[model samples]
Target: MSTTYLNLARKWRSKNFDQIIGQQLSVRMIKNSLYLNHFFPVYLLAGQRGCGKTTTARVFAAAINCANLDAFQKNPRLTSLPCLSCESCKAMEQGNHPDFIEMDAASHTGVDNVRQIIEAASLLPLLGKKKVYLIDEAHMLSKAAFNAFLKILEEPPSSVLFMLATTDDQKIIDTVRSRCFQLFFRAIAQNDLRGLLVEICQKEEIGYDEQGLQLLIRETGGSARDALNLLEQVRFSSDQITEENVLRVLGCISDDQICTVLYHVFSKAKSPQKLIEYVDEIKLESFAPEIVWHRFIVALKIAVWYKYGVSSTGLVLTNDLKASIEAVPLSQAVRLFDFACQQEQLFLKTIDKHLFLSMFWIRLWSMVHNQEAEITSLVTSKSMVTASIDSKLTVTDQLVATSEQQRVTISANSSLWEMFLEQITQVDDQLIVSLFTQAKLKNYDTESNKLEVSFHKKFELFQDLFTKKDAPWFLLLQEVFGNGIQLNPVFESESIVQDVKPIEKKVVDQSKKQFYQSNNSANVSKKDIPLDISDKTAWAMTHALLERFPGTVTEFKEETDE
Candidate 1:
């Protein structure tokens, strides 16, 4: 009542049946019903909040009660379009129309209100052509209220109509819902939001930056009223809205802060305290922990998308992630995103809220430095890998002793590739040995040191077993003695293995350099990769130390927001 010009949400409110956005779908069904003469006494509009269910129901009430809907009845779409110039439309808009009765179920939420409303349904139209009952927040109605009202709604007077609106459809008793025609409204789209904001600015006579408008739309996440209210706040302080101003007003973290944390994650920083402290500093800038967590989640998701050669424009992301993320590896970024999302869900659903935030930072740390601080301890626990001479997997033989050196020879005498078959049989007999199976070597490249191996479709079982990354453990000749060499483990989409290529000089010297490179995820750098181990003595030394210095991880600070 105090404002001069109507804001966008009010000024642009649907005047007719067709003007409603994200709800044209619900309008069509009502129009079709009107055209076919299949009139229902009550209609239920249901969806999440800020999704146009209540708004569309209001427009529907006006349409059916339009005083000037004379010749438009043939084309039902025109029949329900209200003429606001008339007494009935003007009265409905002001919530004073005798025929257009609006009720807030939250206030009139008992059996007594329902009994009175049902008794009023017996009367004919008091002012408009038809009486319309608009019930908002219908889910809040008590069971006694719904049970009492259901009778009149299911079989109402011919002149009476009922419209129920609710954010949660599940809370509405099933008996009441089944009697009424239902319509579902969806969330507004980002592009739809952009046009809505620009239209609002032009109508309100407010000057704003396009980037600032983008920030408003991104921040609102599909709620038009919320976005316009944010715009109103920005206009109060300054005529021209800047990106920085919007971030400040919204208590949003900046792109610089997002990038700062990301750099630590990528560098495999061990100090979890540093990341937590950085987040705490942002809190002094008045940013909420939830928002800080959201920014990181958005940054991580964008990084993953960028790595996949995809663009994040128009995607749902925090504005703080605008230019900070775009070049991280897809695999690593996705891994981080998954970790962030898991934490986010926990933060939302858990009573242990403090642990939620702690887990968030720890997850990022663990992505790079997840294993125990000592390499020897981690390898020894698995028993799958052993420490080599100096905890280096550049070469090792936990599978066999150096003394069991049986030089392998491939005789070029059989069409079936006898040498390859023998190697596969030896490996398969042992359950732990997984690698290349009963297939011909096909060809070998000594110059490039690449083995050109192929598996046919008919031999699917053999192909799966033979081409697996774990195949090398079985002493497959190509993997074990490729060009007179032992290979470091190689990780591929199809397999994980240590490829060994021996030196061309001497057998004695080549065996001495037999190294294994045990790998996990490969998107990380060598230094960031977990150090591999093979010998038992080093692991024993490190485990003892870790036990002596038992590490305890606790929350660096109590949660700021309850």
Candidate 2:
């Protein structure tokens, strides 16, 4: 209060609902609620940092608890907004109100701390009729603390009002969230911020360059508090606030420097070397790597936008930079931007910043070089292609036929299976090859013009694939051969084995032979049959038992006639 200077963010913080910016709809709804006397017991204000969640909460707390509201309510013509001169409003504004409680859950994030609030809610208001509890950063409350506070929030006393403000509303407990009415605050736009900054500068009588203010607007990323803080830094740096002064103070790159770096990246043949030189030059000027990287990314985006005729707002660039940016191809610009973003992620993870950045520039340069080489090779190949067409006419003539007219004649010596496998591997990898190779080539009937393929019972997956009319594999087979080739897929069925008389066993012991004969009497139970688990014929029965019965394996039998 004694200091000559007051920061713009603090001095301009909204004191009443009418002064709140960028949240017109939210503010209007809150005001309407007050006018209708339909105040909810608990209210939740959610938004990003510096978007005025806490500020709005404080103003709403003051308005609802203002002692003068009764008189204003009686006279409908008078303003229902909070009168700052009233006893309750002044106490709230000065942070001395006994009824208004502001608890920052970030520091006090325990069950016991929340218990204190629950205990205090039982007491009557000391100065005003309503007790306002403003819990900022409410998401930071511990789970146990939220559970303890949930009851009070769900059914608070009629004299109490709970206002919870948080940046991340999702972190708040669902039960607690459902009990409260929610309001969302949005970030202030660039134009709104610019107007506010211009007004502040005019009010403070501070000389500022228009471009310099624009830079501050972009740097702050639409946060009014951040913008004001940055403006204060720039205003303190020099007498006149100019773009160069702002860049110097903030350790940001200038537009010309950014353009110089990008132009060398796009126009110079040895881009990596040029980029290295420019980076060194910028470092010598004391530009931070992060700032340089941010500016470089912005410049690359401008190039992309310029190339595609898209607008790049809130950025003031020189005509030369715009021209150079517009000249780059959209694809190259996008690639460079994407590469920079990828490198930036890596840069954030590594401890060795210098080496990573150097390698990043080198990689970018190599990408450009590779693309240039590819383009050159494509052009060269196109020019030489016409010259070789006459020599390759015989080979080309056989391969270039319309789908309906093409007929591939296979030699008698050629193995159809080998040709099909070779063509399959070209289109797909080993996965598809493994799936198809299981099918046995039954026969290629030249007279019927059908390719008969038989699959084992275990290879039924291949049969299913071939049955699809529009599967890629089928189309690929037709393309490799001719459209006239018809595919006939067959699944070989398992045949039942008839009963065979058991061979006479060599009698080991008289008792053992008699016991075996009794167990295998004329009427033999299915479970009494000796199991041949190792035989391939028993696999299906074993699998069925394992799938149906799971763990119990009392008996396993071979295929038998029904």
Give each model a TM-score. 0.60, 0.64
Off by over 4 Å in 2: 1-6, 70-80, 268-270, 314-332, 371-562
Error of 1 at 32 (Å): 3.9
Clashing pairs in 2: none
Error of 1 at 74 (Å): 4.3
After TM-score superposition, what is the CA distance of residue 7 in candidate 1 from its true location, in Å?
Answer: 6.0
Count of backbone collisions within predicted model 1? 25
Point to the candidate with the largest TM-score: 2
All candidates' lDDT scores? 0.63, 0.73
Indicate which candidate wins on lDDT. Answer: 2
Worst 10 residues of 1 by lDDT: 404-413
lDDT of 2 by residue, 1-562 (tens): 6865658888888898767778888888887777777799999999888878998899888888876666646663568578898898889877899999999999999999988988889999988878999999999999999999888888899999999999999999898999999998888888888888888899889899888888888887768888888888888888777898888888887877777766666653434545787778777347666877777788778777777777776355666666655554455567678778877887878886666766666666544443343333444565478558754445554445322122222222124456667768654334456556666566555446587766657656545456665766776666433355688877776532324676555644676878987666664434445544565344654654455357644454433334
lDDT of 1 by residue, 17-114 (tens): 76666666787887666556566888888877676777787777776777666645676544446767777889888878888888999999999998
